[model samples]
Target: MAREPQTRAETSSSPLEPRVREALGQRLQELSYSFDEMVLRIPREEMVECCRLLKTTPGLDFKLLRCLSVVDYVDFMEVVYHLSSLSHPHKVTLKARLPAEDLRVPTVTTVWKGADWHEREGHDLFGVLFEGHPDLSPLLLYEGFEGYPGRKSYPMPEQRELYGE
Candidate 1:
């Protein structure tokens, strides 16, 4: 069965309730808007601090890093991190938007050690540079790969060059 889309109020629940967004907004004044009803759009510069609070805050301890994905929106890029609390049954999506010119954001490895791989994959696919990442080496792409294959502007590699068939 298909579920109906939820309103902003209904989307943000529990761990990432409005209070949490308000708190973050108080600390970081760059809370423009949400990418999705449930997804909070945090500034790229404040991503690390936001992740820290999400992991350590009492009722909103989002300790598990579910996944990290990068989106190329032509004009800019967006990094999304899905977080969940192991001790509680709550989850939220955190996002940081970056300009195409400066595709750098602080690594969340300091907050969640497992973020290392996710950061690497983001870097490999979208050309996002996770500053302070221990290893931003390719996770899916090999060395000498010309450009980010995941980007909308990256040209598709020739099949003959790839397979030599």
Candidate 2:
């Protein structure tokens, strides 16, 4: 016997998807599914508050901040946060964009304490300013490092020599 095809509703979505949508409401810039996980694009201004809701919301308890990382896109930077729920089988990725000229966003350390070092790392390498971060100290780079090495625009020694910079 042949099996019947499943419709979209018959397929399972990440359990956290609806809860996240309801919690964030119109603040979310975009929402989609990738690799069996829910992805939310949050505005930079709403990042901190969104993160707080993700952690504190009853049904959408994203209590574990798995990782935080930055992506340099030449003209802008994308901050990505991977969060998981300890009490539920759910995970979500949140992204916020920061313009190259203003690489600043409020720290999420208030929501997840583990974000402290991650923010520091972003600040050290991407020149991102995590405002209100307790200590934006060096995580992977030495103090007094000149440019944001993580950015694509960071001139290498050869490039600097070629350009006489």
Cα RMSD (angstroms) for every candidate in the order listed? 6.7, 9.0
TM-score per candidate, chains pooled: 0.79, 0.84
Model 1 per-residue lDDT tens digits across residues 1-165: 222222344322443566576657654533322343356678888889998888887888889999988988888888989898889777777778788899999999999998888889889988999999988777888888878889988887686798887
Candidate 1 residue 91 C-alpha distance from true site, Å: 0.8
Error of 1 at 51 (Å): 0.6
For residue 22, what is the lDDT in candidate 2?
A: 92
Clashing pairs in 1: none
Evaluate all candidate structures by whole-model CA lDDT and list the values in order: 0.78, 0.85
Candidate 1 backbone overlaps, count: 0
Which ranges in model 1 have alpha carbons more than 4 Å from their true place?
1-18, 27-37, 157-165
Against the true structure, candidate 1 has what lDDT? 0.78
Tens-digit per-residue lDDT, 1-165, candidate 2: 222222233325665667778999989997776656677889999999999988999988899999999988777788999999989888888999888789999999999899999999999999899999998878898877788888877866686677785
